[model samples]
Target: MSLAIDFYDETNTITEEQLNMLLELVNHAAIEEGVDAGSELSIMFVDNDRITEINREYRGKDQATDVISFALDDEEEGEVPLNLGEEVPHLLGEIVISVQKITEQSLEYAHSFDRELGFLTVHGFLHLLGYDHMTEEDEVEMFGKQKVYLEQYGLTR
Candidate 1:
């Protein structure tokens, strides 16, 4: 999938297998949505304090957030093919995740840490692909697609 993941924090809570699973999950979603295989995406993991600062700075929210996506492509222009005429990979965007929040939410939702992390990863990936939940209808559609994709990837909780 040409996905590049960078862990911002030194904790290293995510294993290589888990990271591969996430990449495959997102790659499957992108393929199903007709995105090119050469598309490049990045996922970054950070601790609570770091994510809290990011939330405040980027989202104007003082609290910690589970995940944040910075999409590089404009959806309004349609799905752009990655690596079309260039040797370099297309920069899809960055997804920043708070490992602290994932742990907390796993407990809150009564699910395993892997499940929560996988869910959050999928959610963040979707956001990078231009999915949003600004309205009730949008929420339904986005969340439904998330559920479908997760289940298809065997990440169901």
Candidate 2:
């Protein structure tokens, strides 16, 4: 499948090789999820302040989250308008990740930075694929799938 992952490192904490690996892992996630090729999504790395603002504005929560996803393929009321009659979609939505929080979480959870990053990336990508964790069952399914992808990517806690 053709998946374009625009990885923006605003924090500049990660190297080019690391970024490449992250992008590749995202592609692996898409393939695992059975997403059609040619889907495009954006992943932005930012600091806590930026993420806090986004969290407040979009999700109505005034706090800094590790990651936030905006799904763009839905035609539901109040959501983004769907692309009609288009073979390739321009947007599947965007994922905003907080670099500082990632490091903190990595340390807090006693895992490698790559592992935390992989978890967040996989979690966010799943959201883009129409997966949600509003309930216990959903959370189990989503987390289970995420764990498998991480294992395949060699990112273990």
Against the true structure, what is each candidate's TM-score? 0.87, 0.90
What is the C-alpha lDDT profile of model 1 across 4-111, one tens digit per residue? Answer: 545454458888877877777777888777776676777888898888898899889998889999998765656765555666766778889888889999999998
**Candidate 1 local accuracy as lDDT?**
0.81
In lDDT terms, which candidate is top? 2
Q: Write the per-residue lDDT of candidate 2 for residues 59-109, one digit (tens) a residue.
A: 899999999999887667777654587775667899999989989999999
In the predicted model 2, the residue pairs found to clash are: 2-37, 2-38
**True lDDT of residue 97, candidate 2:** 92
Query: Candidate 1: misplaced stretches above 4 Å?
Result: 1-9, 75-84
Question: Candidate 2 — which residues are off by over 4 angstroms?
Answer: 77-87
